[model samples]
Target: MIRFENVSVTYEGADEQHQPTLREVDLTVPEGELVLLVGPSGVGKSTLLGAVSGLVPHFTGGTLTGRVTVDGRDTRTHPPRELADLVGTVGQDPSAHFVTDTVEDELAYGMESLGLAPGVMRRRVEETLDLLGLAELRDRPIATLSGGQRQRVAIGSVLTPHPKVLVLDEPTSALDPSAAEDVLAVLQRLVHDLGTTVLLAEHRLERVVQYADQVLLLPDGVMGSPAEIMTVSAVHPPVVALGRLAGWDPLPLSVRDARRRAGGLKARLEGRVPAGPDLSARPASGKQDPGPGPGHGKGLDGGDRVGRSDGTGRSGGFNPFRRRRTEAPAPAAAPLALVDALGVRRGRVEALRRIDLTVTPGETIALMGRNGAGKSTLLSTLVGMIAPTSGTVRVAGRTPHTTTPRELIRQVGLVPQEPRDLLYADTVAAECAAADADAGAEPGTCRALVSELLPGVADGIHPRDLSEGQRLALALAVVLTGRPPLLLLDEPTRGLDYAAKARLVAHLRVLAADGHAIVLATHDVELAAELAHRVVIIADGEVVADGPTAEVVVSSPAFSPQVAKILAPQPWLTVEQVEEAL
Candidate 1:
């Protein structure tokens, strides 16, 4: 019911600056169908949503050279209020969109806005509360909710209208595995049960690919030519990374489909299903021993990953000259470390209870939990962003609370769930420089760190204009400017494509080999398997399970994947590992 015809947008920049962000773009969405807006960051995915919501010219002060019609009305003619009934939108940042202080009132505000009767509003509010599993938090203040809970309220506020179309931009980027599942389940039901047309704008392809009926490859920059961005196309489902690597034509949209296809293909290729990676034995060095060589990095910079295991070393090493080999990782020791008691609180609600844990260095730690499980709160408290309400958190020998953020910067760097909070600079160079400065190092040294973290940041572009992956890279660049020994990434892979995710994993490996500890909080099981050395399942502010990644992921039936691996989901983390087993 929404259409973009030769639409182009030009926005005024700093001090009367004018530039086009989207070219003459053409797009169409049928009713009761699902479409995915897919591309890298800053590709105008948000701008496309703005066009449908009538916020482009009114709020952005832009020139519109084409037509955007929603529900048959020209977007140019209808104000946002007029179109509010037909379409609902959720921005990428859930915190930025909350309209009220409490979850209950937040849900009711939009209903009241539309002049619904109080009785009708009450019924809808109750229904939405149950639908999103927010009934427990209905009366809770919005400020007290976790990132995932806040996002649920955002979705509920919009769904109350029962609009014909729903638009969500990276709804799960900030959530843990359990909480992300909760929000995604609600969206799935909206399409299958309510027949609400869904248009999701996201870069995290693995999460939504399974359900999308259509895939639109939006353009990368501003211009009205429709030359590159917003290239809409039909897509058949397959697992995102698998399809990309196997070069499957008509990439699959779901993990189930990908599993079946992978099984059949592997059976056809090597006459058997791919066995899981052999974790029983100490993994061979997949690459050369760490020392100065052609591939070795200067100082702490990681050496090029051997592109492929040539019976001597591992693949995916930092080798800019050679093509990257599509392979999986070899199994190694699970990362572990010691912890005494850890606890944190937000206002009156306890974010984390008395907790104890230990993970080794050079391991990927997957912290899985439901919304409000206190995963992020724990991470923040650990990294000194917020002090612990009680107990202690440690990296090596120092407690973060006992040390300043500056001190932690050299030992523990935190990549926030929402990366934009750290990106306020006018330019990429300035932001990276600021990050370098915050790390208490010289600007030149920080610049070198930025090049290593982001790999391809130019000097003149606005940091805001960079891609989602680039923005994360920039934030990480700032976080790691001091070469911290412990890095806590709160969903670093959220909203990233397979390529971007792979790159992030590669970066983590680079840092880990140099002895940095990595703890990632995410809802993505697939990502955890591929990257994490261990898995920790958190429920109700306590770590319910902690073990090797394989042991924990498979033990929890609900969190385990149905993907047909040579082994179950947990034991075999990457495609290369599976292939090696086979």
Candidate 2:
């Protein structure tokens, strides 16, 4: 059992700018219980774990005036590694934890550090590899893994130690929906089967809610904030959003739970719910095409030009699916370029072999693979961030290297791995306004558009003071203002809860319908199946397959199925898609 007896942490000011991260926080957790610690980034969620890990004052050089005892051992008296046998940790940035180049070695590294015997280490490593579904990658070099794969390795490294308790700080924060799910699923199983007490700090709640035995609603425990940091927001995911406008309960935790709770309300409304669009109409693969093959009177591949009022859109020569139905007509025709024919590199590391990728407007693209597969690197090249060491790179009829960051901003918006990097403004409103104005919006219109695209942003707080979920929405608000034809998001749903993630997917579905070409780099197969119009797989920096999203995900059995993928080989990004396909 873990107990925080009036836990209060105060850090010495580095300068006048130095601020406190956590305040007095009293909390407790029972043994063998799974607790989820969540709040906006920079909150005391991480500090809470550090208190138990004995890394607070000991490592951070902070003034700690609290008693954090785990298993009756005072954390203040013990060091983190000294308590390593009792607690395991998986951090948000996994790249920092690699102990060796091989997956097998990485697992062995932890046990070896603890001075475990060779036979015990071998057996533990083998069991953990299979449990985490890393058996195939066991022999693979850690240098060869993708971002998601490396994260898995980080988890395996700590878990193989067989600690009594496991603490994961934003373990899935950087993973795509499915990759996040994979990692969470493994953690859930550990708590359920092995009785490893689990404490995780997470921003994304949708996937973890169903599995959580208990939830801790942490306030922004900073020494100074709008509310003294002790006010706890609701920890559970809400079942509905705008439903409040219609006077609904609005707090359903899961789909089944929501449906069960909504039955009585549905009868009271008696069709006032507006006979919501039949989700069953979704296609088995790809979105519903009115035509026989590929829909909408478009040619093969959905390539056509379209124009925008801002002098940015291409006309009939672009992908029509990405153009607004009622907006300005497209510009004169021009040949749209694909990103294939390039080899990408990351410093001394070769991230991608030559990968040829094609992008068409109105199509949602999903990129998948093990960590080190180059999905992130490939996305950067497409968005014009990283240049290809070889081969030409083309995005929106131009090579990424040729496009300036500002120019790329208009055409390509990358939802980065860490949302904090996207935020620099003092306040959430200011950040959104800055994003809109930077994207070439007229004065005053940016704020209105930000409100329209993102819900619950105007709570009156600084962007830095908001939660990770709030910050993620603020970043999205800025990106949506430009309404670019091509949108690239690394992983849009990383730090969000289930309800939040579902809302984000709903928004993306709308974007896809409006003819916005989106390329999402993630480890989430479910999200890919749901929102991706097509799925692209990258292995060792080379694209292996690029086609319909469901088709690509179906090929990998080690890769679990999303809801739609399970029912059909093709992925279903939304529930309605499955219903429609059925």
Candidate 3:
């Protein structure tokens, strides 16, 4: 269905130096097969996906030296509009694909543009709504839909056209575990029942690795079976990592496959306990210790605060079983942020309801839930971007809604879900300079942070020219320049690969040790298990479970990380824990 013949693409550069993104890639994807594209950030994953839909040279000005054919139509000869019936492409950002306000209209808009009959359009729209579980949200505005819901709608919009080949880039990056399963199931049915060819790129391999029949490694653009590619790939899911650690003959892509081969490993770790960071020394007044079991605990009050130590005082490596102690100092007179009975309303919809939360010094709290379960809304309210309909929000003892922009920048810094929302400058250097000027920091402060987060990024390049992961790093650097007491991040790891995410985990840990209170709203379970001291699960805008990381995540099947799921009944949450224990 999809074939590439010695394809190579090069973009125009200001220095008159052209660099090829895809280096003479020759590949073909069979019909009715799901091919997964895997590579590091900026290694041409998105560029390759754009080539399938004729967006590389046609929409994005560049040089196309070879041929890419989708459904027997040459992308070079046929534009995206002409090939719309044969190919459907969904990019990384779902918001960029919406052309209509409501979900129903958005799904039908593609068919309308194709000039399909009214009756046919209606039938396809209904079928797509039921297929993707978007029937209940058909009448809702696209702007109010959650990130994951928006992704589903975007996929539904394309699926309504019934193209021969479906090309998706990170389709399940923002979805919860169950929602991801639903999307994957829909893709599976399309491939099996309808003979639709699916070519997708995803950084979270644990979610989709088992579903793929073939794997395409970018830069090299080599194609092989899933097991063949995953064996030698630098990027892989945690289960594969665990398989390598245990010396399994064949690496397991899914948890079920790994669990069946874990008998001997489980016996080896029978009586071992995860030597995670010490929380016993953390100051908690009038609160009983939840111990080391998986049980819920009461939310900490304003008086109870963890100490803030320097980065040197914390453990150095990623070993989860490494014994370490937090040597942070006591909190000041007031907590960094406080929320009491917080409620927010957008028209008739209640976004947040009666939420009581506190962020003390030197603490990292992760807020997790389904896509539209008020995670983004709560972050916006805390950062003063949205006003609360009722109750109080205080950051550094000042009202967030009433605080001025200058004061708010110093009191709290927020990295929004869309990194582009925080970036406006032309070049990377200019954006860093603006961030430094806005935060009243030294000229090189923001640039240094960017270097620490994303190495080897050119300063002369435009912010939009960078990859999604690089853009996220730049946005994070811009926010961190202010060194605010309370740091708020919404879906910070959306485009980051495993290496980039590991750097982010280390940076956030240092920030937490330096006396900053961090609150992150994310769907990345592995990130929460590694970085957060406390995990808070919010459902329908209310806190459903709040406790230590192991307790909250392990108790719930939907929120647990893959490593925790593989080592069931054991309190281990990461591969490093098991590795160090053995």
Model 1 residue runs over 4 Å out of place are 11-20, 177-182, 192-195, 220-251, 259-338, 345-348, 440-470, 561-571, 579-582
* lDDT of model 2 at position 453: 38
Residue 240 miss distance in model 2 (angstroms): 7.5
Q: Which is the better candidate, 1 or 2, if ranked by lDDT?
A: 1
Which residue runs does candidate 3 get wrong by more than 4 Å?
A: 14-17, 278-333
**Candidate achieving the largest lDDT:** 3
Q: Looking at model 3, which ten-residue stretch has the lowest summed lDDT?
A: 306-315
Best by TM-score: 3
> 340 in model 3: Cα distance from truth in Å?
0.9
lDDT of 1 by residue, 1-582 (tens): 888898988755511334566887877777887777776555577778878888777675668889999889898999888889888988766777887888899999987888999999999999999887788888788767766777778988998878888988887676544556667788788888888888787665555655666667756322221112222222111244345556655555555556656755464445343342222222333321211101112233221100000000011112112111112344243323345677665656666776776544554577876666767776776665666666766666677666765455565666777677777888877876676566556766555655655455566667665655667766766666666666777777765655555556666666665656678887766667665666677666776776555556666654554332423433444555444444
Clashing residue pairs in candidate 3 (N, C-alpha, C atoms within 3 angstroms): 308-328, 309-328
Error of 3 at 343 (Å): 0.8
Expressed as tens digits, the lDDT of each residue in 253-294 for candidate 3 is 899999899889889999999765544434442322322322
Where does candidate 2 stray beyond 4 Å? Answer: 11-23, 40-43, 175-182, 220-337, 340-374, 384-392, 401-415, 418-485, 497-517, 523-582
Give the candidates in order of lDDT, highest first: 3, 1, 2
RMSD of each: 9.8, 10.4, 7.7
TM-score of each: 0.79, 0.64, 0.91
